[model samples]
Target chain A: MADMRTPLSRARGLGSAKKGTEHFWMQRVTALANIPLMMFLVGALVVHAGSDYTTMTGFLGNPFIGVVMLLLIFSACYHMRLGLQVVIEDYIHGEATKLLALIANQFFTLTIAVACALAVAKLVIG
Target chain B: MSEQSKPARPLSPHIQIYRWTLTMMLSILHRATGVALYAGTALLAWWLLAAASGPDAYALVQEVSSAWYGRLVLFGYTWGLFHHMMGGIRHFIWDTGRGFDLKHVEIIARITAFLPPVMTLGVWLAAYIYPGAL
Candidate 1:
């Protein structure tokens, strides 16, 4: 290929977005956080699997459990967004479709995070 | 004119063209399980919403989840959770700058494949043994 850039243009490197590694780093961080958070969730669920409504709400309504549940909700949703972005980028080829999917991924994860957090807060605070 | 100067080249071989390895299978499984777990969040959200919405909603969720199909789905979720957890641990091992050797990779992959089922069974058994103990 023929060189098209001026010497000054070549000298100036492609600008660092400065946030290039944020997605990767956050994914790993959330994945690490999820280990304990999700295990707590699974353990809680298994123990309360057949419980009545009172038992279920009572367990989840406790302050500590509520906090942990909120953490899990946010972390998992964020991690889900990052993971799905990779999948969408890999498989969705159409430019408009890919852009729409990426936007939808963000919105969906945010909605889940908010809904779960709000539900937990309502239970815990009431 | 510039396009004419370039030589026509063969495309690279895709996944189907190569012999599949345990590592390859596990790698894909990791992503597949991740996606499954992502969908499983809907169940989580439903549970939370039901619990917050009061007894009727909660009972409805309970009713659905108690059915055979619900158990089946929950069982799958249980397995997927452990499977994805094991896959994450494997990646963690690699991230720490080790476990790249073919033998070690395959060995870890093999363990990841079987351990999730055993763990899932153990958990279910424990849950059955001590029902609703939270």
Candidate 2:
């Protein structure tokens, strides 16, 4: 299976696909977005603790709150996905296992994001 | 044939080779907390989805969240969230290329470690003292 190319020739064309910077940039962008979003989220959760169904829904149902909540879900999930991808890539060594883990990471993050978004949208819309 | 063709190579010294520093610990803790938050997101999703579902479902979630174990996990999640958030801020600061000096880096690392637990405790304390004043 070995090709007879010189080592320099072998290594010359094998490095970076030129798209890694996008991943790096997006990770930072989403991270910056998460700071304020998470603060607002934590505040809302604290304020809503022990609230009854109607009360809780009424609060989350507010257009402004709901919109911010939606934003939080999006930013947080995106950030979470990016962060977990790094984690998986770092720790999952087996080729097949790494691929499976990366796929599962995407699916899990997508599920959480969609489910959370739907919940917020329903409450807000209703 | 392939097995005989290549000999086993010597491995480089790993994590165990070095003494742990606060900066090293914080860096690892940042990733550790990030992983914790990844799982914590599920709890958040569950809470939101349950609220959307109906009163019975929402109440079940509330009941569980109010339980001792649930509260413990929530406490850990709170700490993890704050810890990770501070770690991110430290990273952002470093990204600006301002915190690389040895003295400053150690100071920044200490702040990352100290602030989160304090903030977490403050939140919990406020929640207790004022009871949803937030």
Candidate that scores best on DockQ = 1
DockQ of each: 0.51, 0.46
Mind listing the fnat for each candidate? 0.67, 0.61
Among all candidates shown, the one with the greatest TM-score:
1
Docking class of 2: acceptable
Clashing pairs in 2: none
**What's the CA error at residue A97 for candidate 2, in Å?**
1.4
- Runs of candidate 2 exceeding 4 Å displacement: A1-18, B1-10, B131-134
lDDT of 2 by residue, B46-113 (tens): 89898888899999998899899998999999999999999999989989989899999988988888
What are the runs in model 1 whose C-alpha is more than 4 Å off?
A1-18, B1-8, B131-134
RMSD (CA, Å), each prediction: 5.2, 5.4
DockQ of 1: 0.51
Find the candidate with the highest lDDT and give its number.
Answer: 1
